[model samples]
Target: MHSVNTRTLDLNLLVVFATLWDTQNVTRAGERLALSQPAVSHALRRLRERLDDELFVIGRHSLVPTARAMELIGPVREALGRLDDVLQGSTAFSPATAQRKFRIASGDFVEFLILPRLIQHIASEAPGVMIEVVPLPANNALPSLLENGEIDLVISTPVAFGAGLREETVTKVSLLTLIWQREGLSPGRFPLDLYLERPQVMIEMHQREGNIIDASLRAQGLARRVGVLVQNFMAMPVIASQTGYICNLPGPIAQAFAQTFGLSCHQPPIDFPEPELFAYWHARFDADPGLKWLRERIKECANTSDE
Candidate 1:
């Protein structure tokens, strides 16, 4: 392969290529870039001539990337991201004047705890900014999502993120046992034997061999019966309120649910460690002012005093 001259290459074509790869339809790509269909086609032709390969081809309805396009996309995205960071770094970030969108991946709990305050702050301070919250990807997919710029930040419980990520502990949350207003149970600390006797509502976000509570119980040769297993924390409160089962949830969430469902919150009989919530981001954007500002805002919101 002959070396192509970088001076003769139009860097703008790479932007077009990335857009095309993302949209997969000429009209859609043109709409995203504010370019006409003919202009986009001409840019693709120029790129093909420069690289001596047809990077994409017309499929049944949309364009499909060739192996060459697949090979180029990763590096192309990285290059563009770095270039964006460099350009953004050159200017001071003014939240009041800047029009930007930040995407965050997190669980429903984070949405409940943080987003309301964050949105209020944004509305008052940065009317032009927008926040999009997406469901957290699986643990193994997190690094790629951050690296690929698919998500700007992640708010989650501590997890082992492999590499190229930065993390900071935002807050530590203790668990509160939520139970129905039973005859024997009171509003204070629950009794150990009573807690052990009652069936529990378990919140399992991921399918795994075992969880921290179970592992801790196993060490002491203790186990509780699970009456219901659920994927969503929001459902746990409803199930706990209606049934004889109990659920352990973060303090704020449990209190909120207790108020809404007319349930009772009690201190768990057993001592369990508080879980720390962390904010994670790609290390590549460590110096990006907008992300930095957003991270601070998230931290502040997470640490807000309970009402």
Candidate 2:
């Protein structure tokens, strides 16, 4: 690492460097930048002096970047991009006229609960907009994905991070008892003791911590005898319906699934975390008018959406 220079850096010079680095030739970079070749050359000289490094030197046909220039280029470009996003004034995105592809990382449960309504909203409002949903990876990749604009929105429980991301709870859910069928017990409502004593079914969304429900149970000084386990929450209704096993899950989701599958949702015996659904976006998108419009639309979709 070199010593930190106290002299102020020229923000404009960095743009020149980016263009020059991409073109590798002063004349072409100047053309791309709409500046005269000599003007670009003068700017480069100033930049080199300020940074105390020959950022680039002439080759036969193009300028080859030095190690230091390469090191500075990426961070400089990223910073400038962020600054540009910030400088943009607030404007609402109009979905009907807008064309965009919004990526989402979500569980099958979230998709099942929210996507149908979201798609309906998009169809009426953002017909040109596209959607690609990916299963949530068991990692903190959502933050960086948001930063890069790879993913537009992530709806889930809160995750820890600094200012790079913004999160807000859009809705809250209580825990519900999920039971498939009652061989002797008719499916109407479930007893709490039936949940604790009966063999439970669960799946871990985490890659490392096998079963999250089990861990949650242990947190409450209780553990379910997980009889059957599956990874996707969509399968929970199917599995529980046939096997008569009981599961504890988010109340709205449980109610929706239970109503669909001839199962029932009841209050649970023990205290459980109130599962919160969050809507989060990257700070990079804070000023994007189109993104701003879509965020409001999404929030509206969530509010009017059932379950």
Candidate 3:
């Protein structure tokens, strides 16, 4: 491939490239861009000649991207999205009119605490917008997923995400224990001895031991008996309601689960540092008006949840 300065590259060809990449057919790409089929083909030809690569080729009646095209697709789409946002300027966000699908990475805790309220807020305020909540990816993959626009936002522990990402404190959380009321355990009588003596149901979502509470216990040279290990916090209500095992959870989540399952919510025998809830996003989207709107709404919901 011959090297050419990007300054001389026709910007219109990039628009064509992005359209064709999305539509994958010359005619459909032309329809989207309001250009003739020949015009779209001509742009592709010029792009191939200048870049020295067949960016796309016909395969099973669809235009499939070549290796080079695959490499360029992410940047091309991102560039076009940024450009579009700039053209829209401050007029970019109108919640009622914007039909966007925002993907969020979250855990069951945040889902219980914030998602319902956020959905209600969106339904009344931005009926056209949609949200998809996905499970938190492995820590190593989160940064790249945010960078590549695979996910728009993440709501998780403050420590789980860092570097290259922007975050805001969403909630301040403390620990509480959920146990079956049928276990003959009084809320006031859950002292250190009984807290340690019970067979606890530990939630190790993603193979992690419990957080601050567990650490505090270990620091005191104490440990809770593990009766079961489960991946989802949503299961805590059922497990604690039926079994004698106590489940330690974030305060708000524990209260909600306790109410729903007729379980008892108690303060942990040992106090731990309060962990913060946070919402994280890639810095690349800092200037994006639509994402800003979404974040603002989430922040509003988080504030309300804390109340």
lDDT (0 to 1) per candidate? 0.84, 0.72, 0.81
Better of 1 and 3 by TM-score: 1
Residue-level error in angstroms, candidate 3, position 47: 9.6
Candidate 3 structure quality by residue, lDDT tens digits, 146-244: 866789999888655556688988777777877777765676535788788878777775237457766778898987787788888878678878877
TM-score of each candidate structure, all chains considered together? 0.78, 0.69, 0.74
User: Model 3: runs farther than 4 Å from truth?
Assistant: 1-4, 10-81, 159-163, 206-210
Deviation of model 3 at 22, angstroms? 12
lDDT of 1 by residue, 1-307 (tens): 4467988889999999999887888888899999999999999999998888899998998899999898887678778878887775668689999999999999888898889999999999989999999998788988867866789999998889866789999888788888877645766787878777888888666325366667667788988788888877889889988886888888889988887876888887777777788999887677778998999998898889355
Backbone clashes in each candidate structure, one number apiece? 0, 0, 0
Question: Candidate 2's residue-wise lDDT over 117-146, tens digit each?
Answer: 879888988899988887775446666567
Ranking by lDDT: 1, 3, 2
* Winner of 1 and 3 under lDDT: 1
Q: Give per-residue lDDT, candidate 1, residue 293.
A: 90
